[model samples]
Target: MYISFLFSSFYMKTEYVVLQILVLLYDQDVLTEDAILAWAREKEGADESDKVLLQQSESFIQWLQEAEEDEEEEEE
Candidate 1:
């Protein structure tokens, strides 16, 4: 599966490490909020950029959920 994903997208310079993570999360249905937070905590030490990225990710998740809820309201 990983090899197939690699072959489909040759343009992006995706590291195997990142791709492996995507695969693990997607294939195993492991992308829970708790898991994501734990992973971020383990990897993103006290670096300022990491801090910013974590904040942005959180904001994006919140925005996406809100957007989905709005869409559901419109459909109803």
Candidate 2:
């Protein structure tokens, strides 16, 4: 929910740029693939804004889903 608000409130001012930001954030470790996948898959308790953001991020989600996510995370 918070992630959706941040992207929608800050990034979606002029044009739809959620996909770009998602890639950047995921690459930068600001967001993990698990986190993004979980949020994107949420259905119950999601508000309209969340639904909108989820819809806007469909392509990114699809791309993430197709990628090899089998690597185990390293303990930090």
Candidate 3:
């Protein structure tokens, strides 16, 4: 997964390796949902692309939460 931020005429790219590391951290419970959401919100700006990303992130987070609840119910 490639995540990039555009500022002015320049584009900043986040490396795939860094994303993989973040995934690992999340899997280990080192990164909480609130933390991820906060980070995403903080990065959001007036750019259209940024707004799209924020919306996607919110959707993804909701999906994750619902999946977790389903799993817990199944275990019960």
Candidate 4:
């Protein structure tokens, strides 16, 4: 992923990886909901350090799940 390679140890100061960017990418269709959910839920191919980063986005992941549920219900 671009994030893992684009950022180095020096730039991973918590603030560098804006969790909101995930939402923006989703909104823009640059990233699909399933892909983000897979990354967050299974940490499919994440390295050890990147796994920690995924943990940091836990709340956002919950929000995504809730939002998806809500949208599905609305469509029903």
Best by lDDT: 2
Q: Write the per-residue lDDT of candidate 1 for residues 1-76, one digit (tens) a residue.
A: 9987877664244444454564467458778644565655665676785564455455444544576678889999
TM values, all candidates: 0.29, 0.59, 0.42, 0.56
Instruction: Write down the TM-score for model 2.
Output: 0.59
How would you encode candidate 2's per-residue C-alpha lDDT over 1-76 as one tens digit per residue? 9999988787566235777788889989999988998887784368886587777778888888776343433322
For candidate 3, give the lDDT of residue 40.
69
Index of the highest-TM-score prediction: 2
Give the whole-model CA lDDT for all candidates, comma-separated: 0.57, 0.75, 0.60, 0.74
Cα lDDT tens digits for candidate 4, 1-76: 7777667654555544556676678789999877888778778476787787677667777888898899999999
Per-residue lDDT of candidate 3, residues 1-76 (tens digit): 1333344213223333445555677789999766865676576665776564455345555656677688889999
Clashing pairs in 3: none
Looking at model 1, residue 25 earns an lDDT score of 76
- Clashing residue pairs in candidate 2 are none
Q: Give the candidates in order of lDDT, highest first.
A: 2, 4, 3, 1
What total of clashing residue pairs does each candidate reach? 0, 0, 0, 0
lDDT of 3: 0.60
